[model samples]
Structures are given as structure tokens and as C-alpha cells.
Target: MGFEDLEPIFGEPKVEWDQGQDSVKLRPFLFHVSASDPSHLRIHVTDFHSNTWEAVKSVVQLEDMRDNIGIGGSWSEFVDYVIASIKSEDLKLVMEGHSSSGGAAYAKLVGQKLKGMPLISIPLTKLLDAAASEAMANLSLELFKAFKNMQHSLVEEQEQTFQLTKVISAEKERNETIQSQLDYYSKRQKFQKKNATDKADVSSTPMSNGLQNSPDKLKAQEASSTKVVNRVVPAYRRAKVRGAFLQDAEDAKDS
Candidate 1:
């Protein structure tokens, strides 16, 4: 009729620890506190089950259940109470249940959003199967399957790594080729610039020398032209004088 009667068939509830209020606790472990005065509250401790003991334990932990209980048959209200209780932030739910409590405890750890820990369930049924299976039984084939899968994964990872290595090596070779080409181009540019400058200097030197020589050549040509003009002017003056004298003699003879 009661848990005591059922204890023989089902294992007794496991005992959990309480670190007190204001400390962080995980899920499934409920603590109740009651207050002697309206301003104060008392503490009750138990699991989160609907058992009679849990009901009594809740009251002992809290002054009243009015603030913690849900409206009749209201799933939403019950969930709200549970969520509000956790939000108190001052209360902690210790994880301490075993077997039947395992599911509840694991849920609390996960539901309360505990960090750095995950729930692990090792069912007794599975444990028995694993223990009783023959060494060569097909029942344990899952191990072989997992091993083969792991091997495949390793092969894939190795292939990916090799591909990455080849890609990196190719990139390095390309960079080297580009660098060599750049260097070659830079050297060629410098050489071409020097060659062009040298050609310009050689061409300019001859043109400048020719330009300088042109003034002297012009002076020599001008001097030769002046000498010829002077000689021609003297000869023309002598011819004029001879013609005038001949005219004067003819006039005298006519007179």
C-alpha cells in the first residue's frame, strides 16, 4: 500500500546530500524550508516524486506550498512552479539519486542547464546483455561495427590531410614561381632602363657635338663670302673708272 511495502520489490530510494540554500544545485533533488515567522522559512529535503514522503518533505523545506504548487491539473502551472523554484538562484538541487532516481537526477542536471557535465545512463538490461554475450556472439557485433566505422573515418581524415598538404605545397610552388618571375622582370626592367639611358647618352653626345660645330662652320662660310664680295667690288669700281675716261676722250675729240 505504501513505499515501505513496496520497498522489498523496488529498491529503497537513494539518499542525497544538501549543501544548503544560496548554493547552486542540480535538478531532481528538491529541498523545502519552512519559516517560523512569516518573514522566515524552514527547509525540507527530498526527491521530486509525488510520493507521500516527498509531499511531507516539501512542507518541511518550505513554509507553505501555496507559492510552490500548481493549479489543479495545470501542466503549465506545475512547470512554472518548477522553473520559478530553480530561478530562486539561492537554492541548489544536489544530484544524489540512484537507479529509479537516475532518470530524474539526470534530467535535473540537464534541465537546470548545468554546464561541463552530461547525463550518462547505463541500463541494467544493457549491462546484463553485454556481460552475458558470448565472446564470439553476433550480439556483440556493434563493437566490430564501431571499429570499422572508426577505421573509415581515419582513412577519410588521412586523405583530407594529404589533400591539404598537396594544396599547400602547390601554393608554395606557385608563389616561388611568381617570385622568380617578378625578380626576373625587375632585373630586366633595370637592365633595359640602363640600356636606354646609355643609348640616349651616346645619341645625345654626337648631336650636341654637331650642334656646337655648326657655329664655327657658319663663321667660316661668312668670312669666305665677305672676301669674295670685297674682290668683286674693287673690280667693278675699276671698270666704271675706265668707261668714264673713254667717254671724256670722245667728247674732247668731238669738240
Candidate 2:
């Protein structure tokens, strides 16, 4: 229903009328309720500048009202059900002073519904303490998670660095081995070249010093000298034989 329907239970609500515009505005009011004894259960309905109405509209839209209130139940019954659902020992309502909106009489009538029910006021410091404790707890949890993540990242980085170092070291050892083999080959090539150069120098040095001889030239010079000697000796022998024959012939003629 409407606020006008609640006027029977909660006194008359303040109203403002504009005859010129033919419009009416209902002044906001507060409704307070509490149970008897010291159970600390209470409920406060404040509609200052229609703030309460706006909050309710945000939660329960017009289209979803049927689902929340049901087809047979009235708005008043839905409100009653919400109130009955709260356990007297489970909930505590915190009240604060509001600026006067000329609804003190309506609040007084609504407060009379539950006689001997006293308003249990909670201190502002206690609320602040509870809020600070919860905030600190949440901050600590976030910091713990951040530290854990940082530690995990550091471990991952360390592992990656270790693996990289291993690869680098292996590469270095391989490079060293390759370099050593290259050095060995280079030394062997240099030694072989030096030996070949030394042999060439030794062979050329004998030729440069005129110590190399040919055996065919020496044998040809010896045979030419022997042939000249044999021809001279045979000619001298023939000349001597002829001289002896002339002597013999001259002796025979003188006889």
C-alpha cells in the first residue's frame, strides 16, 4: 500500500499541500521500534528527504515486487515477515540523532507500541574500533598474498638464472674445447711448415756453396785423356823399328 495506509498504525504523517499547482508532498518521518527487555533487537525506519524510499527502490524494483511480496501477501505482511525473521539476540540497531523534521509526535506514538523496550545506544568509538580492526585484518591478508607472490616470483627468477648460468657455462666449456683444438691444429700446421722450409734451405745451401757435383762429367773427362796417351805411344814404336832396318841395310852394302 502507501504511507497513507500506515497512518492508522503510525500516527498521522506530516503533509505539505500546494493548492496553486494542485500537488501534495508528504514530509519525511522516522519510525522506531524495539522489543521489551535487554535483547538489544531494534529497527528504525527513517525517510529523511525520501532517502529511505530511494534505497528500497534500488533493492526491490516495481517488476520484482510480486516475487518478493507474493500474490496473496500485502506490503504490510511482507514488512511483518522481515521483522519476525530477525532474532532478538542476533541483531543490534545503532541510532543517531537527526535534524528536526516536525515528526516527533508520530515517532512517539510508534515508540509506544512496545512498552518497556528501551533504546540501547552504542558508542561511536566502539563502532570505529570494530571497523578499524576489520580494515587492518583485510590489509594484512592482502599484504600476505603480495609477499607470497613476490617470493614465488623471486624463486622463479632464481631458477631461471641458475638454468641460464648452466647453459652459459656449458657453452663456455664447449668454446674452450673448440679453441684448444684449433690451437693444436694451428701449432701442428706451423711446425710442419717450419720443417719443410728448413729442408728447402738445407738443399739450396749446398748448391749455393758449389759443393754439388755430377758423376757423368768426371767419367767423360778421364776417358778422353786415356785415348790421347794410347795414340802417342803406338806412333813412337813404329818410328824405332824403321831406324833399325836402315842400319842393317847399310852394313850389308859395305860388306
Candidate 3:
């Protein structure tokens, strides 16, 4: 409850302790006692004052007290609990510290002391190790998440690329098919046109020749008929006269 209560158990502190005012330097530790609501007992395992970061000129401040030996409001209860924890003359206080619950730093204050020794030690190495482990864990988690995201994105990109390639290939195939069709159509059209031209030429050749030959045949027929008419009519009349003359000539001959 007060400094008086602590004096009996811990003896006169290495440094004089004031109630609710400041800390008491107890050898290698600094003891903080709070009398207000949410009363706490903070024991430093390191010399925080000596390790204070330099602020302005002559203004130094302790960045991290990091001194946690024993905590909680009931000192008597913890004292009794620690006493009861002694099994077979072995003063073992194996407390598993939790720094993650309530989203706050380590809640349990941890410190050490040897048997029959007035000195309490706050191992800075252990706390720093814990802090480092926490930091590393968080960093590892962040890195893992980042890598996972990258991997996911890479996979997605690959899938998209594959899909795009497939689409391109399909389009290419389609274009090729269309091009082939066009070529086929072009060749067919050319062949059709050539065939049509050839057919037209063949048909026109017969038509032209027949037209030329028809006029020649018609003129030949007219000439032959006219010549025959002229020769044959004269010959017919001569035949009649020549028959009479022949008859006269025959009679003359006979005479």
C-alpha cells in the first residue's frame, strides 16, 4: 500500500523511496510504486537513467524504462504466491510472459533474484530478445504477406497472360481461317471468271465463224442459181431453133 509496507519485506531500499513521487534505486534495479488507482509496482532491470537519450542541452529522457521485474496490485499476494512456488527448496518462478494481449506490451513484470540475496536483477538481454523476437515475427509476417501478395499477383498476371495469349492465338487462328477462306474464295472467283471467259470465247468463236460462213454460203447459192438460169434458158431456146436448123441441115446433108 505504501513505502512502509515495502520496507518490511524488501528492507530499506538502496535509495530512499518516496511515496507516489519517484522511483527508488535498489542496487541494479529501479523500483516504481504507484499509490493511485490502478496501482502498480514496476521494477527496472536496467539503469534507465544512465541510458537516457540526450534531448536538448541537459534535457535527457529515458526512452524505454524496460524495467519489469514484478507487477500487479497485490504485492502480498504475489509475495505469498512466490513463496508457495518454492518446491523442494528450489525458488522457481517460471512465469510465462504475455506482451500481445489487450494489444499492449508485455504485461507481466519479470525479474530475478538469487537465494539469500538482497540484489534483484532485471535482465535487459532477455527483454531485448523478446522484443527482437516480436519484431522479427511481425516483420516476417509482413514479409510473408507481401510475398504472398506478390505471388498472388504474379499468378494472376500469368493467368491473365495465358488467357490473353489464348485469345490472341484464337484470334490468330480465326484470322488465318478467314484469310484462307478469302484465298479460297479469291481462287474460286478467279477460276470462275476464267472459266466464264473461256466459255464466252468458245461460244463467241463459233458464233463469229458461223456468221461469216452464212453470208458466203448465201452468196454462192445466188451466184450458182443466176449463172445456171442464164445458161440454161439460152440453151433451151437454141435447142428448139437448133432442132429446126438441124432438121434443115440434116435434110441438106441427106440431099
Instruction: Compose the digit string of candidate 3's lDDT tens values, residues 1-255.
Output: 322233111111232222442342333322222112223322222223221111011101111121233334464554434322221133211222223321112212223343543223222222444553443344345446667888999999999999999999999999999999999999999999999999888776766567657978789879999998887455555545344434477788889
The digit string of per-residue lDDT tens for model 2 on 1-255 reads 322222111112232222342243345433333332232222333333321210122113422543633434665554443343222332322222332433221221111113343222221121123443443344345446667888999999999999999999999999999999999999999999999999998887666344325666667768989898786555656655545545577798998
lDDT of 3: 0.40
Off by over 4 Å in 3: 1-127, 206-255
Candidate scoring better on lDDT of 2 and 3: 2
TM-score of each: 0.33, 0.35, 0.35
- Give candidate 1's TM-score: 0.33
Error of 3 at 52 (Å): 18
Residue 235 in candidate 2, Cα distance off native in Å = 12
* Model 3 vs. true fold: TM: 0.35
User: For model 1, how does the per-residue alpha-carbon lDDT over 72-101 read when each residue is reduced to its tens digit?
Assistant: 434334434433443343333333333342
Arrange candidates by TM-score, highest first: which order?
3, 2, 1
lDDT of each: 0.41, 0.42, 0.40
